[model samples]
Target: MSKGKFSSGVDLPLPVNAPGVTKQERAYQAIRDAILNGLLQASDRLPSTRVLSQRWGIARGTVESVFERLQLEGYITRKVGSGSLVSAVIPDSYLKAVTDTRTGEPDRNESVEIEETPVRQEGRYRAQVGVPFVARLASPLLIAPAEWAAHLQRAMAAMKPEQMCDVEPQGAWVLRDQIAQYLRKHRGIDCRAEQLLITNGIRHSIDLVARCVLKPGDDVCVEDPGYPAVHRIFEKAGANLLYAPIDNEGIDLHGISDSAECRLAYVTPAHQSPLGVIMSATRRLELLDWAQRQNAWIIEDDYDSEFNYQSAPLPALKSIDSMKRVVYCGSFNQALFSNLRLGYILAPPELHHRILALWHTIGRSVGVSEQLGLAEFMRGPAFLRHLRRSRQEYQTLRDIVLDTLMAEAPGRYRISGEHAGFHLILWLSPDQDEDALVREAERLGLMLQPLRNSCREIDLPPAFVLGFAALTRAQARNSARQLARLLH
Candidate 1:
């Protein structure tokens, strides 16, 4: 009497009892049940709509309707050439079946092989460099607003159709406009949106610039104890690196000019890496003049200039670049999160199209959704509010760190470069073994860096670069205590 069968293969439910259910509905329910009951598996192709229609004595349109319903319900997936397949949503009973088959133990219901993620332990003390924890922490913690999220969601939904087709090789124009406005307001670098070429991040931006400008084995001047990653990138691009030593003022232009074969120079003039020194206005003018005279390009990495603790943010090297010699690179990696991977290059107007072409050959572009979200974020009132909040936070943390060091270590450590950015360099006594101190500090639950590590060779008068931005005031105090103990 029943058409539906039970586990024992005996008929259970009478098909006549379900009078209102259409034949198409019946087919859809049967296929869905088979999928949920573990009879059909993920990736198992289903019968063609025509075959099923013929076998079940239903119209082809009706079968097509059923398959479409199944697809909408996530019971099946359709591929371009490959036919519809069973979806991978396993029912609770099917999961139980899997566990039962593997161990033959019926009572074990817990999900096996799922390991707990370990908690990130906060270090008591640290002196690591090359990261902008202070500049980041100084900025107010702005969670992306709901409107931003909504914009991203809408963009992503639209991207489904657009992605199936081709996108612009340069980048999304809307994002370029947004970035241009942001840079104009904050960095005072005047440019059209068309001149900007977006890349994966600062490193990728550097690669694009290198590809556009330099040839293999061409000599480029890099600051001594400069960004190590920059050196690697230059080498990979086939450039012979020449060292330009940095002083308290910034990269020594005299040393750079003296290099016989140095054709280009990379400098973090706004705020030097590791040293935390700002290139004075006088030196900046001199460097620009030198570059013009030498017919060389200046790669000004204006990283972390946004969180200037002492004074108003310095004008970027590109701001005064009348000769069109500066390839200005900056990023939200420090201002926002590191993984954002959105950095930009402002090449001279003449080089814009060339860099754009180079970017197209390297990678497609950043994700459409993220670009849209960032564009919306930059236009909003929240961004300005966040910037103000970050400035105060960084300043407070900097003060707390300075006070702690003065109270604890006193004359033992000479603190330098606390005027801007997220860290200060501590020059230690000559007798101290910088490497040994760092290793011992690590064992005692402190993360520190030896000044020598930043150098190509050994450095005299051991020093450490300490970052206080990621830690709270209380955390900074506690870390300072641990550092004081380590030093003593």
Candidate 2:
């Protein structure tokens, strides 16, 4: 058909001469790559052997042999008169998942397969409407599906054959270039594409850094009531997790110093999880200074810096890190849909290749189509427009939660972390039993995440992190009343 090229989808290219590889082998490889890369989509019609051989300038016999191999491998189905069609069930679902060389296990598709994805007028993710979310987090409206689909279409259509064959482990250079620009503009971080590494998400970024640096029994510092998963990631890498209690300014510097042995620290300075306090500029400087002096790296998880409702959000900790001690981590999952699983790490120039080397050693990568599509999306003005709409919508939701809860039960509890993020902390009196409240809430058909879950050693007043991003007006009010009643 001679379809135009794209990263999300494209036409196969003719095989070029190789010193040792046979013409048959090269032809086979090209078709197989097309199938794997979604350049030949599920159930798409394939060109007739005669047409392909003539078009690609390959020998008729070699083209026929290639087709035979593809058919035998179930990559295509041949019907005598109907011509050949691509398999209805392709091995790779839009995104190619290669077998991990180390584990010998094929990676699972992270994105859900859509038989027919419908784009609503409001551009909501239809699949997430009633789906049970992981991590007790909620996503706001951050993407225009119709526009996103169009961008993806363009992304696929624009891919050249060479791109499918040569994938970068550090990430697609175009995507990294966009990210470098995005960070500089949005987060005030000054970095080049060379310093950026695209990851599956923040956890993946952290895991890679941990693997690259940590040895068995090495000490890693974290905010006491920080992201629980970060704690586990550090622990999984055989490092002893040390807790640095978070205060009003941010993770306590004094608490961090208690672990003179620690060389790595993870902080959520943008909006600390559960507690929701922006790390003060002074504290940011202090943390950066500490990391520089101690020769340690600070993992600054930039959570919810995009959705600040009060004032313009502060610049990211990484922006202030003149010492290059902060390794900035963030993801599109919270901003986009959860399954996007696309994130980035802006490491210091010195740490970039070490992290890249670890990424290379792992030999796992997010599919080329998603990367190219995302890069295309970010390259346009559409992303900022979508982000603005999302921020406005989430602000309205945040107001609803604040108003409903305040009117229903004044002074019953104090809310923290409400200035930013999809979730906020409902802090009850210290005497209140947080665990019992959580259990009672679940019994009442509501999920309440206990603050203790994020904390390792810091003892605090009873509190629960309340997620409200996806709640409708009615749901917000009803849930507020339900939670207010529980306090009684």
Candidate 3:
């Protein structure tokens, strides 16, 4: 795909990403920009699709489509072997002379159409989420009941004419206030609405934090058996992710190099994912001290912390941050349903404005209807009732699974991390192979997520992450017996 004699002068610029614009749109704009700015003169040769695609890191088909579009719009012409050449006359009449909408004065290169889809998606996207709550445990109801819909209707109906055009990047103040109150009353996190920035979910919050706070090559300490998506997020953000292993105390701080100049630590202190070990009080302070000493930040993901069976869950890691090094994130997706698509970050006061600015820049906020409806709901008893209902329901499901497993499996396995969260750990005997057990479970039509699947490198004792939420009593019993047979 060499450009022959035209390779030297051909300068195809890369796409500049605009919020809500697709990569194809950006690439189109890039080529058009190259023409309008005189970087690509009339009659100048353009590179082959392969060359342009390789240079732009876009798919070759995408580059070809852009070329086709350019040709369609009278911008480029292609010959059999000479490749693409800029048209003798580029379309500049409208592009060079865009009129200002307010004053009717000639504007310089400002008007371009980029199709943007709705950023905030809300509503009962599914009847149930996570554990298939409706199908297995409760009546087949959506995450939101009829009451929620009525509230949403009222919310939308109540919007004033001017309010329809409002944009709240930090999200509606009412929702933030509700979240603040909820955190204070339920999670023991003392925070104000002013310090909160609404997000899509914890994943989105983590991504923003990494992009905003971490620079390329900055070392970030993450839990080894942690959320796989988050590991990819950090890597994508150009941060060097160091998978710090977890122990009964939580993430083994000693394993993390004290002198590596780690810029951040990501931990689920309340309920360690997959393993479900609450960070001991001593370890929490030690982690805080480590962050303070290293001048690093901590991302406390309070996922599934809402459900604790053993005792009252500890306050979030941010609850006792004397040095304000922790950025607390929580989501209603797990608390309510996965499709809620709403979460918030309690950014440290120092980082609040930065995170908020980034939030606004990305236009990642829930829609007015969802936010307003949720605000109203959280302001009432229904939200608390929902929590209570879910807690009770999960506890029932937990009991069923426990009874069935205890009866069926007996002494073949040990369970941990069952005190909180929907999943529990089934620690297999050392001689049992995790992969073999997983494959056997698959063969038996039972879902068995190996604990090793969550681990990055360091080996953990053989175990299975037995998630029982999506199972009914019968299904649970059957699966338990199947697992018992496999283990025995």
lDDT of 2 by residue, 330-448 (tens): 89877777778799988775676677777777675688888899999999887777778777877786778778778877878888888788778888965667778778877776677
Candidate 3, 1-488: lDDT as tens digits = 23233543346565566455567766766776566444566677787889878887889998787877666434667888788887634233322332222256633222332112122412131243333211111222324578778878877887777657867667778888899987876575777786677788888889889887888999999898886777788898788878888887778878778889799889999888768887754466667778767888999999887787754455676765655688998998777766678888887656766676677677755777788888878877888788777777777777877786688777878988888787788888767777888788777766566777779866888877777665566666666767777887
Which portions of model 1 show Cα errors greater than 4 Å? 1-151, 154-166, 257-259, 457-460
* Model 1 TM-score (2 dp): 0.68
Residue 436 accuracy (lDDT) in model 1? 79
TM-score of 2: 0.71
List, residue by residue over 11-35, the lDDT tens digit for candidate 1.
Answer: 1121242544577656765675565
Clashing pairs in 3: none
Ranking by TM-score: 2, 3, 1
Better of 1 and 2 by TM-score: 2
The 10-residue segment of model 1 with minimum total lDDT is: 114-123
Q: What do the candidate models score in CA lDDT, each in turn?
A: 0.66, 0.71, 0.71
Query: What TM-score would each prediction reach against the true structure?
Result: 0.68, 0.71, 0.70
* Candidate 3 segments exceeding 4 Å error: 1-144
Model 3 accuracy (lDDT, Cα): 0.71
